[model samples]
Target: MTNQVQIWTVIAGLGIGTLFIRYSFLGLLGNRELPEWFLRHLRYVGVAILPGLIAPLILWPEATGGSPDASRILATIAAITIGVWKRSVVGTVVAGFGVLYAVQYFTG
Candidate 1:
């Protein structure tokens, strides 16, 4: 396949897969109450996925060509510490980006 065809094929596949995943939950079970155990587990899903999402960016940022950067690492640490101490989402995000920008600016 041509590059454009290949890209469109992948995009269409991902769209269909995402729609199916959403429909499986909302279309089939939207009105029903999920089991207590399931609900409890679901509550932690975001918390679990967040670290997985952030870890790669911190450990091997694309900007650094997949090498670990000190600024990103320190920012992550600051963000985690602020999150634990303040328990504030806004505070955590502010601290993380703030540290990331400040360190990058000063060090470079």
Candidate 2:
């Protein structure tokens, strides 16, 4: 795999990116206290990111190529089903992945 990119570089990049990303929030917050206005608005971060969280599922489902297949669709439906039926986030994710993998095995 001489022509292939170095695995270390890819890992290093992932590490740097992860560090920078996590640092952006934790580092800034840990350095000093943020203003109350910023704190007041912090609650909205979840609301603001809500669309960012769901947009890919509906619009760019194919972006990830494999994970977003029909199994994922069924898994998402399963997640919603768990949320409605059990109202548990942990249960939803677990059940969703299970549903996805099970259906993927059957289909593939």
Candidate 3:
């Protein structure tokens, strides 16, 4: 078990580190206009980040003890199919969740 002093020290260190990391971006570059190329590339940050964030949950869900679950896999497929066929974000999400719940309901 960690002592109170050590725990507070670590917490304070992390707070300071997070502050600096955020300040380095907002404080330093907040005034300057970013280049067009950088801005253009930044548009895809969401495209990259969404998959990076969601892939692990679908592929190795903690609910399944780090193994892939069929319901989630089928949901992903349904979502992809809806995304490709309808090209609608809302439709894709609805399809994914709808399939996920339906599969889990039937399977479980």
Candidate 4:
């Protein structure tokens, strides 16, 4: 198959899979409250996944061609600190980018 065909097929499959996953929960749990244990665990999903997704980038950024850099690592640390302190996603992202750029500029 052509690359475009393969890409489209994957996209379609992912869309259908997402639809089923969403529908399964809504349909199965209609008008029912989720168990407290499950709900509590679900609350950590974002926290857990966000760090997992970000840690690799901070440790070995693609922009640095997989090399570990002080600027990115410090920026990530600052961003996490600001985020936890302020509880603001926008502030955290802005701080992270700002620090990353500043560090790159000054060091280079």
Candidate 5:
């Protein structure tokens, strides 16, 4: 069992670490214009984040221990296709749900 002092110390340490990270970003780069190379990488942040989000869904459909569902796979495919073909946000969502519902009904 941990003592009160130890628990308070851990909480304090975490709070300090969070503040330091957020402040460092705002302090160092907030004032200056980012370099061209940095900007180029930042432009790809979406490419990185989007796939990171989608990949887990496709690869680990039932990561929480339930049986995997196929509708999600079909929806993702439609979203990617719509995103590629029309490059429209609405189109992507509509196509994705359209695929999901269609797959569900057809499969059911």
Candidate 6:
């Protein structure tokens, strides 16, 4: 069907675009030491990206039909607390998921 073909075309285009974006930096910076200023800024990339990716999901979750849910809010708080206290990615994820399931179990 034409719709299926269009979907596949879009998927392929996205895959290629993501690949090129990832490879561009590696290829362009091969065997080169980045400047200290650039390296310092790069350290904040994850810090910036994590909050950007999470804020929307916490504030307007798709599962809740874009509504703010208590479970998600509490879980996000717990995750942030654990992340700040323990400074561990795995710990933060575990705490978030655990709190989410616990809240869902009790509330639902």
lDDT of each: 0.95, 0.81, 0.98, 0.92, 0.86, 0.94
Could you say which candidate leads in TM-score?
A: 3
The lDDT leader among the candidates is: 3
lDDT of 6 at 15: 100
Tens digit per residue, CA lDDT, model 2, 6-52: 88788889999999999988988788988999999998999799779
Collision count of model 1: 0
Candidate 5, pairs of clashing residues: none
Off by over 4 Å in 5: 1-9, 63-69, 105-108
Q: Give lDDT tens digits, candidate 5, residues 11-103.
A: 999999999999899988799998999999899899889888878777677653554577887798889999999999999999998998898
**Could you tell me the lDDT of residue 69 within candidate 1?**
90
> Which portions of model 1 show Cα errors greater than 4 Å?
1-20
TM-scores for every predicted model: 0.77, 0.52, 0.79, 0.75, 0.70, 0.77
In candidate 6, position 101 carries an lDDT of 99
Clash totals for all candidate models:
0, 0, 0, 0, 0, 0
- lDDT digits (tens) for residues 24-58 of candidate 4: 98887877998999999999999889878988898
Better structure of 1 and 3 per lDDT = 3
Tens digits of per-residue lDDT for model 3 on 5-88? 999999999999999999999999999999999999999999989999999999999999999989999999999999999999
Among all windows of 10 consecutive residues in model 4, the one with the lowest summed lDDT is 22-31
Q: Give the per-residue lDDT digits (tens) of candidate 1, residues 42-75.
A: 9999989988997898888899999999999999
Q: Give candidate 3's TM-score.
A: 0.79
Which regions of candidate 2 fall more than 4 Å away from where they truly are? 1-37, 57-68
